[model samples]
Target: MKSKWPEKLRKGLHAPADALGNLFVESFHYLALFGIGAITAYAAVATFIEMLEKGGISVDDILLLFIYLELGAMVGIYFKTNHMPIRFLLYVAITALTRLLIGDVSHHKAPDVGLLYVCGGILLLAFAILVVRFASYRYPSTRVIDANGKDMDDGKV
Candidate 1:
């Protein structure tokens, strides 16, 4: 013997509780994302002020700022779409390696094994970006929008 009600109506009995739980989880997620965005913005401003106090900005400083900006942008994008692009992460890695290489060559030391390693990392990340781009072009993802305007993947790729 089984319940006569359809699943939706049967589950509707606990829908209030389920909705409350979901609301709590969603609120917590929004709060965490806002906190991260706020902290990143504060850090970016602080870095700018520090650079001003130092009386000048260098290429490394600019690159660091770009990293911060990219991080903040990534957070915003994630908050909006709930999706993150892998290429953006690769871009961040490439920029960071470039900054590290520049800092090591001019500020810290002459060309060394560490510099070589950083250059190698940059090259690797660049290749990864190219591969990802090629894959996206060759094997495109088919997205269908649901009634709610959310992208539902057809999983064709």
Candidate 2:
């Protein structure tokens, strides 16, 4: 019979390296997320201050604030659940495009095909968000667990 000791010995030696590597990488990753969240919050505050100075807020300003909110929420969710919901990203992109379209079209009275293109892009992004949600519902991640650390097999959340 083949000796099982060698395999056990190898695994024991490799475990520390795997664990340390994960710790190193995740530490920096979370640090980066914190930095991004901080910068986003700062920028959002600056934008709000600018709007206050002007004594009025435009639709574009509101949309810009919405973008910042989504970004901040994305970072917060990551810290809370260790998972980033991609729908937040799609929503940000769609909001950005809408802001761009509104700003561009409102400034000039002339009609252009660019409006159509931007609208199409927004529609495509909406469709992508639906697809992501559908896939998440259909084939969910297996990391769902209950209070006792056992996998919950009831249904997708």
What TM-score, over all chains together, does every model reach?
Answer: 0.80, 0.80
Worst 10 residues of 1 by lDDT: 148-157
lDDT of 1 by residue, 1-157 (tens): 8766887786886889889999999999899889999998999999999999999999999999998988898898998888787888998899998988888888875687887788889999999999999999999877788887776775433
Clashing residue pair totals per candidate (backbone < 3 A): 0, 0
**Per-residue accuracy of model 2 over 7-86 as CA lDDT, tens digit each:** 99999989998999999999999899999999999999999999999999899999999999999999999999988899
Worst 10 residues of 2 by lDDT: 148-157
Give per-residue lDDT, candidate 2, residue 90: 100
Instruction: Please give the RMSD to the true structure for each candidate, in Å.
Output: 3.6, 4.4
The regions of model 2 sitting more than 4 angstroms off are 1-13, 144-157
Which ranges of candidate 1 are over 4 A from the true structure?
A: 1-10, 145-157
